[model samples]
Target: MNLTTKILLPLIWLLCAIPAGLVQAQQAGQTKDNPSYAALADLLENEQSREKLINELRTMADETATQAETVAEEASAASSSSRELAQTTRAIAEGIGEQFTALAEVVNGLVDGQVASDEQFSLAGLMEATLNLSLVIVATLLVFMLMRRLIGPLLYARLDNWALHGAGNTPVIRRVICVALAAAVDVVIVGLAYVGGNLVATFLVGESGEQTTQASLFLNAFMVIELLKAGLRMLFSRRYDGLRLLPINASEAAYWNRHMALLIGLLGYGVMVAEPLISIHISAALSQGINTLLMLAAFMYAAIIILKNRRRLAGIIRTKAEQSPMATSKISLHLLARTWHVLALGYFAVVLVLVLLSPANALPFVLFATLKTLGIIVVGLLLSTLLGQTIGRRIQLSPELRRKMPLLEARLNSYVPNALRFLRFLVLAAVILLSFNAWHVLDLATWYASEAGGVLMGRIIAVAIVLAVAAAIWVTCASLIEHKLNPETGTGIPSARTQTLLSLFRSALAVLLVTMTVMIALAELGINIGPLIAGAGVLGLAIGFGAQKLVQDVITGIFIQIENAMNTGDVVTLGGITGTAEKLSIRSVGIRDLNGTYHIIPFSSVDTVSNYMRDFAYHVGEYRVSYRENIDDAIAHLQNAFEELAADEAQKPYVLEALEVAGVVALADSSVNIRVRIKTVPGMQWAVGRAYNRLVKMHFEQAGIEIPYPQSTVHFEGSRQGVAPALKLEQAGERYSG
Candidate 1:
């Protein structure tokens, strides 16, 4: 490769590429006119077109670099020009606006506007507004001071006059005047406060000058007139018993007045009657309803206080009645007082409930109603019981009978009262039901499957479980005749009746517990038990058959326990075995025989158990007597010994009632046996038997009565044949025999 050739090769390639690019540009123009042709051209000439695009991109790069440098210089000059123009425009606009509005461009544009400096006198409006507000405040303070200094004294004088002249022990008219005066005072206070507040707000928002001062004065005068009107209305319309200053009888009137004042005050404050006087504006309907509720509450409160204080106020009535000309003799105050308080409280409570049920206090009212109902029930029950006790005490009866009769009296008292309460509750419940029915909130059909039913059933189940558990306990304890002296010792052991009752009770309780648990579980899963139980019955039958043996075992255990064939300490023998009875139980019987071997027999297999010490036992043994001894003398001596032994302290506990000896039980190979027997305490036979034997032996030994042993005779057998054969043998035999 030569340099000239390389240069010529490059030059040739450039020439070819430039013409090829030109041809491609022309082809692109042709294709642009016919898009279908362009697609075909692209597919066939893609390589050529790409080469052309690469050459064109190199040219574009060179052009873009030069143009970018020119644009950068122009942009810099334009930005500089724009900044200078913006500053000049801002300064000019601000200066012009300031000249027109006569406001300075203080820091952070606080006061920037256009106007002459002479027009800036408006700034003084701030101070003028302030002075006007201060004057209004001073005036309001003077009004307050005047009311407190003058009106308060006047009202106090009125109340004093009313009190001195008011009727004693009665709701007097003078108290009403006092209430009206107090209401007037409240209205004055509120009006003054509202007017002062309005002045402050108006000053804060208003500009100084005649316009502001004129507005302030007009508002002040209007507010003052409104306040005076409100005060006058409150004075004339307010209710109260305290103005009378009566001793005791002005309770109801006093209560009504105070509560009415409170209600009015509450409404005034809530509605903002003065000073920026923003209306609550919830709705006219809502306002009317609330006012109605407030009125009702006022009445309810007054009634409640009256009733609650009835007893305290009763003396007023008595005093007045005594002072009256018509009353010659004293009245029976007891009956009137008794019924009055109860009736008043009851009526007041009912009214209170109604007041609470009003829309404003629905939830609180419902809760209070429930509490009140429960309280009434409880108080009624107590009152009935008290009445019963009073009557019972007054009636002629023996002291013991009277004391025992409390339970009967209580039951009787409880019966009628509880029944009446229950009936009342039922009526209330029916009303509630009707309310729900009217609301259409509950569908009768779906209620069983709904959340409400779930909650209701849950509470019912909880109460039922508690009652069931209580009933089970009662039944269990019913059978247990606790020996009061041995409560601790006997606690571990079941009484006969206890075992019977506990078994039945526990079984029933267990079944109920399981059923309730299952029901609760299913209920949580949203399953209704009414249908579930029906299905379960079918399933239970199948399961029951499959588990018959288990059922039988449990049933057998229950019956054995119920019958109490064996107890913890009882000794019983069973199943062809002979052993000392150790334990009798529901599941099995434990036995330990003479050989000290233990045996356990199931209750089912324990058909015929021999209880060794069922009720009592006998201690029987024999004493040995010598055959050589005189039988009558020995018997008499033994009898004497037996009597003495019975008197013995160590052995006497085992003797039940008597001890006797049955003569000559047997003639043994070594000694004659004299049988003796005695009735002994249960489980005490063995100890008594051993003690008796010792006593008999010692007595016989002392009496010199020997216990005979085995004795035999020996003779020579050769004597019969030896008569002729041997005289010596016969002589020897005779000697031996002798």
Candidate 2:
């Protein structure tokens, strides 16, 4: 605007413009305060916040996409790995299938006789086998001939001498020696044959093929088996002239010998043939079939023999049962016989099944197991019988044992059979363990080595040893105590008190020993004996509380016994009861009064005890004499009576000291009192007193010394007017009548 006027005009224009600018500014301020404009500003701010939130969401989405891609890549890699692993597993399976197929083909070929053709049926093999067989037969014949020519004659001579010299009267030892000599001869012959056979077989099949090795084995087995059979036949011959080991009838011996030989031969043949077939790698199916037939035939033969002899077996079992010492043992024998019969049948059935179902390779093991079981049983029976008989005989013959424990001897005689049965059980357990080991059924050693089993076994062994030791100690102590307590002619008899104390002590010792044993056993068994001991302590405390009176009585009685205060047969006054102590126990004293009433007084209740018969007792007698009699004479008479009692042969031992008369102990109105005292041995006071009193009465009567009852004189004051008193009484009676 212009400066002056223009200033005015400019002022106006400026005022107008200022007004307009103020109006616009105020309107703008108002619009800002308006609800719609404020809402728009808030909407803008919200849009900006939403835009920021959208940007963050887009970043998160991108990151999530990257993570998902990584996960997809991992899944794809895992899938590829799994596919590769599956393909590898499939390839391995296919390889295994091919190997199995090849093995099957080899087995099929072998079973089809392709592998064993050359070894089994070749001319060279046949010739070698025949040669070996011929050599074995010739060697056996030579050995038999040599035995017959040299050793057999000598053996027969000795046997014949034994039979002629003793026969039925022969001692067991001599018979056993003759039998042993015969067995030796047979063994020598068989041993020679077997050795020769082995030499021939080895020479013929030296380092040869499977067929040759089989032939060698067959030849040796056959020779040994045949020799054993022959030896058995010779030992068990039915002929009386022959050496027979067992005492059996001719018919029974013959039956057993024939059947046993046949059974042995059949079993040996099966074993020999089956073993070779398996060793030579013959066809499995063919070998199994042949073994099955052989086992079946052997079993059938055994069954036939057993069935035919079943009656005989039953009779034998019954005879043994009847002869058994224990009646209960008959049941056991019957059970054993039944079990044996069942086992025989079951074993045959099981073996037949095994031969049919199992491979040829298992046949030898089965047969060996069966034979081993049989051998163990026979050996066990023989050993048990020998040990039982020898030990039983020795026990029965022991004079000292019989004298010391007559009752025990009788019991032992009765229990000898049971002891043998226990031995048999032990043998059975051992055999069962051995059989399990052979079959590899259970690893006992490994099990025993484990923590729990080791501890358990140790506990068992320790408990057994401890129990045995404890029993020995108990028996020894009991025997000694019994010997001490016995009332023999020369030995001092045990008094009732001594006997009672000894009995109580023995019972207490037994209780302590049993308690200790139980605790030790529980500890060994892995039981927490600490708690048991604590419980015992608590229970003892409770008993002490509950039975305090009993405990007190026992303690008091013990002290009294230790102090020798009273004993049985002593005249004692306990509490207020006076009687003879009949019995003494730990808790109470039993007494019998003169009235025949028994009193069992607890020691706790006995506050004061007075034993009359300790080391010595006193017997006192009182005699009253008339005043007219001479005191000196009466005293002298009493002394004479006492002296007479002391000199008496029947009362001399009871009277320890001479009697003394104390003159004039008390004087009554009519008589003088005199006392005589005698010292006597214990438990004789009453007898001495009675005798002294009776003697005093007899002496007083003989000496004319009056021993009188109590007397008193009464003085009456009779006035000089005794007649006036009588008159007054008469007049008073008359006046009362009026």
Candidate 3:
């Protein structure tokens, strides 16, 4: 219990433990080998030694921490993508090389008479299956051929007659139907072949393990190859002009059809049957190698065909394009001609590479891409043909219809050409997307099933619906306005005011519709349109502030129009200019005066508008006669002139009523002035005024009532102081002596 006792106990335990530890530590070798651990033995022996050991331990910890920091830095750098891309690329290349070498070895072994399959090869079974499939195909062909022999002549004859007669009016629909029917027949023939193959396989080939597989392979190859050839035949029917979908001549069609059919058949049989059989009976390696070799050969053949015919076909296509009636179609044809060879070459290259890259599983990928591409082309052609027929190459509106809707035919003419081009672009985009989908470049189907895709499609549909509704409303309003403006639309001639008001209304409607459509479309597209509207309001406020004159013009113009101050085609005096109101807009009015000078006057500057053509105009003629003439006689002559004016057929319609003679209105120094007032039709006042003036002058002279001329008495002011100054008017060149 004493402190000394505790210390001694601790010392005794330390001594005992040190000896045991020292014995164990001897196996760890000399102190120099592990000084740090050895220091532990001297921990309680010396203070200096303990401090030294502490220093050493601290130094060792520092070194360890530094090494750890270095390692962490290296790891961070490695984690970050700091390495060159070539490294991963090299790794992949090496992997493919190793895999390819291993496959090559397997294939070589098979070639060296070593089969890696569990079952022995059966050449007899293969031959028997092949023979059966051949007989099936032959029987199927014979059946179709006999049927064609019976019906083909009639079909061809009908197609020819239709094409011959249809071209003058329409031929695109006829061509499409003919091609589609022929293609269907070709497909049906292939169907018959497939059925015959199945029957033959059941009854003729007989079933066994390897035999069944072999027979199935042949049947599949026959069906696939025949169907593919059928499509090709539809594209370019041999010696059948009516059935051919392409625009090439019979010889060119026959050549392409034969070559393409052969190539397709070769690839189909090899890939579908031969390779599969080889893989099953011998080894997969051999099958893949054989497939790769066959694909390479086919690629070479296709390359040759494309290269050899490239220029020739391009020239032909160019010629066709040059002769095409539609500019859009011509442009499309030209582009196709320029790029088709490249596309074909690229397609083949891509297929070959894919097949080689994954020989075992590339069959579905390749077949799907090929078939999808063909289908897209066929469908596009059919659609184009249908569209061409529906929205014909040339649209001719009836004279009555054109007259009724004056602008409609022009609008359609302009719209159709651009629509054709736009539709072609849409078709091209669709084709590209479908092709990409088939190749798994982009999985559109997968996207369409996603939430985001659903939202997008819904928004698009909604926007389209909004646009359609807006368009319908606009068309209705426009038609109504047009009917009001057009005299021939069963509505009588519209007044100038009506025309001007309707034009302005149409412009306002367009602006309103566009604004509404855009806002709704944006909302449907998941855009927050509240901010857009706010921004627009702010912008409008800014514009209103900055363009006060414009606003004033518009406001004034509106008020002016509402008040019936002026209308288009009205002869109005505005802002000190007298002219016809030629063009009336919301902001300004265009006026052309009698002097042939055109003026654009903003309504804001118009203090007053004087429309000379309103209701009725006045033709006030003032007649001045010599003082010597009788005022009563002159008045009588004026009455006579009015009578003559009323009798004239050309001036009678304009002069609305009997002329009111304001008798002896003015008595001047040399003559008496009589004012005559008459009412005339609006805008015809000037013509009536001119005719009345002429009649008045003639009547005044005939009645000896002279028109006034200023007369002066020449009594010299200097002669006032003298008696009556004698003044004589003499002719020129007379000399006078004063």
Candidate 4:
């Protein structure tokens, strides 16, 4: 029973297990084949990949954060640098602004007349200054008085005696020393007074007191004026007969003295008192008004003086021009006169502008500029005059120069005054430039610092120096040539071949020098000399190609000249023409024929030349006599006639050798020819031949020698007709008979 039951239950369980297993196996198969199951597995793999991607992203984000922080720190540093640069720029701008503000304040002060308030004025200071100034003045006066009393009379006497007795006999050095001593006496007195006054002032007052400064300036100005006055008096002495330093007429001297005194007084007052007072006490408007009034008064005075002396000035200029031999000097004097008037008007205009339009501070600069310009002009004029006189006197006094180049000396001496005028103009230009610099009209310092200005100025100076050197070389070479080729010495005669050669050499040297100078100047002026030189070479080559005949002519002429083929006055046969050589040039020979026709023969075309009047010449003559006359007798008579000709005083100089008869030279049908030859000096052959002919003729006539004409006897070979035959026969018979 257990086996059956167990088997049945086992069967039931096995059956249930089999059904469940079947269902599970079917589901597994379905699940394995479904698309959704594959999708789920892929989804699981995707989830794992996404987790790894997230971790990588977190690492990248941390690196990005670190980089951002570093960038922000760099940006902050850049901002700090920009702010520092801005601060530096602001500081520089502020500095420039401060400079401009200071300049503006100075201008404002000048315009408002507030400059003097910078310094305080006190009664105690004024009192002390007054007392010190009085003491200085007294001391200066006492010194001046002592000098005048003790030294003046003695110096005056000595000068007077020297002028009366020793001036003419004294050496130039001694005379100059004496004149200098005489002129310096008054200067010494004034100098001593000034020194004493300055010493006293410096001792009494400290160096920086306004009153002391003003007094010292006044005293210095006064001393200068006195010295200038004394110098002017000494230069243009009031006494017409005294030893004067300047060459001026008495009336001119007196006029200059009066004008100079007035000018000096005005200058002293303006410099010492008026300027100080205007600066200290006057308002800008009042100072301008006062300055305008002073300028008007000075202009009026100067204009009146100039107008009054116009005729006198013209006369002086005319006289000076007349004294100079050069026409250029006359022109220069006229130009100077016109320039003087223009300068005066220009000065007046400048003063007017300064007083009316310019600020008060600018007025002082204008005044100072005017004074400096005037001084420069005066110094330039004086130097020009002195240099002109010195050069002229030196030229006149130099015996060697006169002997070497008389004509050149004469010509150069005439140009001395004109040269001086040019020098004065150059100096005036220099002074004007300096004045412009002083007046701040031009920024010369800045301009000079620039490359363009510096290079340009250097080039200009180099060009000037080159020109001057070239001129000096030319002058020296010309002088030497003139001395060597002096026509008066017979060395430079037109007839001399040496002279012609020298002339050509001189011309060629001058052209070479000029060409070299031009090239050098162009190089100095920053020109491309290499290209210029290359161009010149090409041009020269073209010229050489084009002017081959000219070059040939020149070369041939040079050889001819070197060989001494012909001279200017030589009678020569050239280019199939016989004439006297009138002129000789580099490439041609000029000849004037006896018929008054002139011919210039190129050396290249001249194949040959026969100079007739070189050293000696032969005079030959032929005399024809009758066949009956004796040849020996005629030759002897010709010889006698030639001897007589040679014995004559007029023909002796021309005869270098005695006349010789060659006996019978030829035998002719009508006469026998006898040739006579005589040697004579060059250019005298024609005269000697003529004289000989005349003498021979006279001697032949006295000897009864007859000259015969050509005659011929002919015999007919055959008879043409009966009568002609008869006449021919008769003629033949007569010939036979003869």
Evaluated with lDDT, which candidate comes out highest? 3
Using TM-score as the measure, the top candidate is 3
Candidate 3 per-residue C-alpha lDDT over 1-738 given as tens digits, one digit per residue, 9 for 90 to 100: 687865654443343334444555565676655443443545546566556555756886799999999999999888667454555556546645665675788767657766666776677865775676666556656765776677678776677557546555446667777777776776776677667656665676565322366667777787778777777877888767777777778899989888888898888888888888778766776676677678889999999999999999999989988976667779888999999999999989877766665665776888878788788877777676666655655667899877888776666666666656557667767877887787789999889999998889899889868976886687668877886799877658888888999988999999999998998999899899999999999998999999999999999988987898888999999889998988999999999998999999998999988899889989888889887888888888888888988999988888888888888888888888888899999999888889888888888777777786888885554555676545655568785543
Better of 2 and 3 by lDDT: 3
Q: Which ten residues in a row have the lowest lDDT in candidate 2?
A: 10-19
Top-down lDDT ranking: 3, 4, 2, 1
Error of 1 at 39 (Å): 46
Mind giving the per-residue lDDT tens digits that candidate 4 earns over 189-301? Answer: 88888887777677655553333665666687768678767766766666532445556767778877888688667855664555565445433333334544565677777
What are the models' TM-scores? 0.35, 0.62, 0.77, 0.60
lDDT of each: 0.54, 0.68, 0.77, 0.70
lDDT of 4: 0.70
Q: What lDDT does candidate 1 reach at residue 514? A: 64
Tens-place lDDT per residue, model 2, 1-738, is 245753443333322212333455456665544433333333335655446545755886799999999999999997998898787667645644554555465467666646433355344655665565566557656766776679655667668578547655334445556666766766777667666656655564444333355555555666667666655654466655436545456677788888777777676655675545443544444443455457668888878777776666777877777776544447766776666666677777666555554435566777577656655654554454454454446345376654544445555455555556565567667666766765556677887989987988899889877776766666666655665566652266787567667776777778888988888888888889998888989999999999999899989989998888887778899979999888787899899998999999999998888999787899987789898999888888888887899889999999887766677898777777888889988889899899989998999999988878866685545578753322222464464321
RMSD of 2: 18.5
